[model samples]
Target: MAATFNGRLFLKNTAYLTSTGFKVILAYSRTTNFFYAYYVLRTLTAMICEGSINCLALAYVADNVLERQRTSAFGILSGIATAAFVCGTLAARFLSTALTFQVAALVSMLAAVYMRIFLEESLPNGENLTQPILKSGQDDHCQDGDLSRKAPVLKKIPSIQDIIGLLKSRVTFSQAAVVAFFNSLAEGGMQASIMYYLKARFHFSKNHYADLMLLLGIAGMASQLVFMPLLAPHVAEEKLLAIGLLGGIADALLYSVAWSNWVPYATTIFAVFIVCVPPCLRSIASKQVGPTEQGKAQGCISGIISFANIISPLIFSPLTALFLSEDAPFHFPGFSILCIGFVTMIAFFQSVLMRGPPPVSSHKISCNSLVA
Candidate 1:
C-alpha cells in the first residue's frame, strides 16, 4: 500500500516536472544511462516494500498449502499477478497517467483492506505465544543477568540467522538459491534490455509494448495455471526446474537474435515452459526445509532474487551499452542478450546437478500401514 501511494506520488511529481519544463532526461539511445538516479531510487524503495510483502505472502502460502500442492499454489499466485499485470496494462492504455496511478493506489488500498478483513492468520496464536516462552527460558538458562538485555533484542524484529543457516544446512536449499539467483540475474537483464531493444530495433511504441506484455502475461498465466499443475504430480520439481531453465535459455537466445519483428511474438511459445521456473524452484526449496522454517526459507530466496535484481543491471547494462554502441567491439548487437542466455544456461546446469527430493509417499504409506 505504501509503495503504491509512493509510486502514485512519484508519477504525479514527474508529470508536474514535465509540465513545468523541468523535464526528466532519459537516454533513449544508450543502454548504460537507461536508469536515471531518480528512477533507481524509486525502484529500490518500491522493491524493498514489495519484496517484504512477497516474502510474507509466499511464506503464508507455504504454511497453509501441503507439500505436494505447493507448486500449484505458488503457480496460482504467479498467475494472479500475471493476470493483474495484463489487466493493469490494458486499463492503463485508456486512462490518463495520473488517473492510472490513482487507480493503482486505490486498488492497493482496497486489497489491503480486503486482506485485513478476510485473510486469516496462518500461524496460530498458541504457537507464537509458546515460542517467546521457550526462547526466554533458553536465554535465562544461558546466563544469569544477560537475559534482561537479550530478551528485549529477541522480542523485537526476528533475526535473519535462521534464513542464512538454510544455505549452510541444506544442499537442496542452496542449489535452489543458485538457480533462483542466476535465473533472476538473467531475467533482470531482459527487463532492462528488452524494452530498449524493442524500441530501438522495431520502433515499438507504447501500444506495441503493451501488446507484447499482454501476450506474454497471457502465456505466463496459462503456463502457471494449466501446465505446472498438470506436470507437478508426475515430474519431479528438480526436473521441472531444469526444463524451465532450458526453455528460458532458448527464450533469451530467440530474443537476442531476433531479426524480424515477428520473432519476439513467436518466442511466446517458449514462455509456456519458461514461466514455470520460479514456482518449481520455490517448491524444491520449500521441500528442503521443515514446516516451521518456510518463512525463513522463502525470505532467503526472496533476498537472493533481490540481490540478483541489484547486480544484473550493473553487469548487463554496461555490456548492453558497449555492444549496442557504434564502437568496433563486435558485429552482433544482440551480444548482451546472448550473454543472458548463457547465464540461463549456467542456471540450467546448476538445476541439473540438484538431487531430487526422495519419495515421501512410500514412507508415509508404510507408516500408515504399520499404525493400522
Candidate 2:
C-alpha cells in the first residue's frame, strides 16, 4: 500500500496506537482480567497502523538519499534505533512498571506528533512512481482517470506476485533476500532460546539480562553511528555485510561454549557487529530497483524477515528445549546456540559469494528522482 500510495502519509496515524497503548496500561493498573484483552487489542492495532512502518521508513530513505550516501544514511537510522533501545533499557531499570509504561506511551505519542508536523513526503504530490500500469479490462474496479473509482482496496496491497516479480527482477536482490532470510532465522532463534539457556546455565536474573542488553546496545550504537558511516565510504557494502555476518557467527559460537557467566558477557564485544548486517543488506537492495520501487523492494525484504520470525522458533525452540532436558542424547546446554552460529555461518558464506551491486549514475539519480 505504501508503494502505491504514500508511506509518510500513513506514519502519522501510528500515534493512534499510543492512545490504545495507554488504555492497555490503564487496564493493567486497574484489573488483571481485561489487561490481556487490552494488550491483544493493542497488538491487533499495531498490525493495522504500523505493520510495515519500518519498511516504509527505509523506503523513504531510499527515495530521498542519494545512492552514494545510502549506506551511511541507513547506518545512521539504525544507530538511532540502537540509541533508543539503550535508553529504554536503562530507563526501565529505574522506573516502576506503570511509570515505565506511561513514559513509553508519552514518548511514542510525541514522536508520532512530531512526524505529523515535520515529516516531508518522499513521494511528491501524491504521485506514486512505482504504481503498475493497469491493462484495459484487467479489473472492473479500476476506472481510468476517475478519482472516485480508482481501484479496490485489495489492489493497493502488495501480493505474492509482487514479491515474485521483485525477486525475478534482479539476481543481486534475490541473493540478498536469501542472505536476509537465514540471518533473520538466526535472530529469531536467538530471541526464542538464548535467554533461557543463560538462565539455566548461569542462574541469570532480570538484572543480568538488562546489563547484557545495555552492553550490546551501547556498543552496537557506536558501531552503527561511528564505525559504519566511516567504513561504508571506504569499502563495499557486500564486504561490510560479510564482516557483520562473521560477527554474528562469532557471537553465537562464543556464547555456545561459554565456560562461565563472564564469558557470555564478554561475547558482547563480538555481538556488536551483528547489528550492521541488516543496514548493509538494505543498502544493497535499494540499488537493485529504480527509485519508484523502494517501497516494494524494502517491503519484500521485510516480508522475508517476518516469515523467518514466524518459523524460526518452530524449528529452534524445540531443539533448544530438547538439548536442555536431562533425558537428551547430547550433554551440551549450548548446542542450540551453536546451531544458530551455523545458521549465521550459512549467511556469511552467501555474503562472501555476493558482489557489489552496480552503482547508480549521477544522471540517472537526478532524472529518475521520485519527485515529479
TM-scores, each model vs. reference: 0.77, 0.85
- Score each candidate by Cα lDDT: 0.69, 0.76
> Across residues 100-211, which tens digit of lDDT does each residue of candidate 1 receive?
6556656655565566567765642222111111121232333332222222212233355534555866677788899899999999999988887777778888778778
For model 2, residues 33-129, the per-residue Cα lDDT tens digits are: 5676667767776666543666777877877887778899999999998999999998989998778877776787677677777877665322322
Give the top-scoring candidate (TM-score).
Answer: 2
lDDT: which candidate is best? 2
- What candidate 1 gets wrong by more than 4 Å, as runs, is 1-48, 124-161, 359-372
Q: What lDDT, from 0 to 1, does candidate 2 have? A: 0.76
lDDT of model 2 at position 26? 53
